[model samples]
Target: MNVSIIVPVYNEAKTVERVLMELVAVASNDWEIIVVDDGSTDGTRSILQTVCQEIGVAVVFRDHNGGKTAAVKDGLELACGRWVIFQDADLEYDPRDIHRLLAHAETGHRVVYGKRRGSWHRPNRWVFALGVLGVDLSILLLFGRFVRDHATCYKLIPRSVLTSLQLRSVGFEGCVEITAKLMRSGIPISQIPIGYTPRAMSDGKKLTPAYGFRALGAALRWRNWRPCPSPAEHTGSSSTLPAKRANSALN
Candidate 1:
């Protein structure tokens, strides 16, 4: 199957090259990399141009920084792959997980998420856990399914399913919107445990308490948002996405 790896970048010039190199080394020829430069004012754009020329990856430099959802949507519009992987430009997440994700995808899974599972024993950990809990509760009250980590970054979806999703959030809420939409749409998704290394704010980690609240608010508003069936459904492909209107429709 053709795989389109979508990397949404913003001020990640420091690590984007390494991520691209890993993709080139591990992915097959039919796999295409689409790097969406979300209006990086740093050297990120220059580095992306070089990578595009050298590695034959498609680079999209948006007119302005539209956030992660827009970048992914832009790539989806241009993707010709049978499946799509939403990857982070930062090397925080491992590229090797792609192989694991494909393992599930190849076995007839329509949606696969790399779920993060680890104990948070520190005081700050409780605070983060509380935040995650609050969001999960909100999602459950509104929709019905419980999402362990509604904000994880590693999600691999079929191209047809992804393309049919109409996303509007501009911040961390993108994660909530996508997950809720997928689950509500009734698409069967499998979760594979993955490692997550928390980064400090100084290390270019952008999620903040404010973004968290915004995400929760977005999830509440989109609680009724359902995903529409993809064009592939009529063709009897298991890869076809199910219809959902809210994140709580995960079951």
Candidate 2:
């Protein structure tokens, strides 16, 4: 397989099907879709079952709510592609941007990020600006590089490099953890501008100021950590079971 699209979903019933359809439309046959439902209770699970089955995508249903990091880790464990893209199921980020990110990968870039363009709907612009500044400053202090969107959900990482990291975050902090590890390992990260449509808290947007603080803490905690040795190349076969059978395996 060429690419493994790992979508970590929570209560995204409103947008999950549309996001999956967009992914399916943009991705080629060699690409595999792995949707990890993090114990969604808003009928998102039922929607995923139908959509994933219709598209022949692999869906892993968690018994209880684990955070985004845990859902991503589960999908990574089952990925059989050489590269993996973390795509959010909330539809904030566009799936078409994957093509733009892949353009850099084709030129030997192992890590690529989709930088958000245009203004976002923020409750307080100053607070959002400060949060972005905090994350960028934290990354600069830890890795000596400034990453504009440290908490972006559209990071495309090589499966080899991704599996090598000692990832331990269980929430939004995973973004910082991954960035710190990649930068410390001397991986060149490229970025491209992408479209973004931010959702308000009332629209099921989960990020908060508390999550930003946690991300900053995670960056500090992992600054001095060394990268683990890369594991032997994964040779596992991809699962072809229907969504129902896949959920059964999760149990």
Candidate 3:
């Protein structure tokens, strides 16, 4: 498969089916949709099973609720695609933007983030602004690069790049963990402006102030981190195929 689109779903029963249908509509044979139902209790799993089966996508069910990080890690283990992209079950982000991210991939960008245009539509604008400022400042202090949307769900990463990182955040902080590790690994991340439709707190917007603090802590912890050497780095083996392909595309 050329693309592995990983969708980590939680208690999003009302929207999961629609999200799957949209993904199926946009995906071709070269794209594989991997849906991880993260122990959803709101009948999301049943909807996923029917929709995934009908659409011929792979679905994994966890016994209990794990964070998005755990679901994403499990999906990565099952991914066979050369490139990996993350999609949320919530309808805040549009599946159509995948094509735009893939276009940059065609030009050999290993890491691409769909930057949300303007502020989030949440009630408290100052809270959202503060969160963004904290994340961007943390990234700048760590990598000397200011990323507008470090917590964006639409991060397109090469399979090789994913394999190189040792991710440990089990909560929403996983976004910071991935971004920090990728920046530390000497990878340049490209950002493309994308649409966003923020959901209200009553509409299952799960991110909390505590999650923001945790993400900031993760960023601080990984500031001076370095990746362990891969077998390809040590022995120059074929395990480097993805990286080689990415580099060739850049040239």
Candidate 4:
């Protein structure tokens, strides 16, 4: 397989199916979509069951809600792509931008982050904006690399590079942990602009200033870590279906 998209969902019944449909429209037959239901108590699990069965996207139903990072790690185990990217169930991010980030990976960049477009709709997001700026500055202060959005959900990484990392974060700090580890290992993120549509707390937006603080702490913790096993080429995997055999929804 070429690209593997891992979608970690939790209580996103309203938007999960629509996001999957968007992914189907953009992803090629050779790409794999692995949806991990982070033990959602809502109707999301049922919807994913029906949607994945119909469209043939791989789905993993966790027995309990183990947070987003847990679901992400579970999806990674079954991923079989040369390159892997993440898609949030929330429509804040545009699925059509997947290939734009993939374009950088195609040209041999292993790590690509999707920079969200400015919010013209919400002018009062200074607090949210400040939290993100704190994350970017923390990385810059420690690694001498200015990463605009460490909390962005749209990082495209090679499966080989990802699996090689000693990923240990189990919550909202996942993105920050990955970025810090990569930078410590001498890898830098390549940024690509992508569309974004902000959602409110009433609309199930989960990020908070507390999460940002936790992520900043994570970024500080991994500054000096070294990788024993550097990134190597991944051979292949049996988890992915053949391109010719992929269902019409994915083709």
Position 163, candidate 2: lDDT: 88
What are the RMSD figures for all models against the true structure?
Answer: 8.0, 2.3, 7.3, 3.8
TM-score of each: 0.85, 0.92, 0.89, 0.92
Candidate number that wins on lDDT, 1 or 4: 4
Clashes of 1: 12
Which candidate, 2 or 3, has the higher TM-score? 2
Better of 1 and 2 by TM-score: 2
Q: Specify the poorest-scoring 10-residue window by lDDT in model 4.
A: 242-251
Q: Write the per-residue lDDT of candidate 3 for residues 184-221, one digit (tens) a residue.
A: 88888999988888877689877876767787789889
Cα-based lDDT for every prediction:
0.75, 0.84, 0.80, 0.83
Which sections of candidate 4 miss by over 4 Å?
A: 238-251
Model 1, 1-251: lDDT tens per residue? 37878888999888899989988898886677778888999899888777766776677777689888888887776676777888887776777888898898778887888887665553355666678778878887877877677777878887777767777877668888888888778877688887766665677766766766887788877878866656763212222111111111211
> On a 0 to 1 TM-score scale, where does candidate 1 land against the true structure?
0.85
Mind giving the per-residue lDDT tens digits that candidate 4 earns over 116-185?
8768557446777788888889889988888888888999988888888868887888988888888877
Model 4 superposed RMSD (Cα): 3.8
Provide the lDDT at 79 for model 3. 73
Candidates 1 and 3, the one with greater TM-score? 3
Residue 6, model 2: lDDT of: 92
Which residues of candidate 1, in runs, are more than 4 Å off? 117-126, 233-251
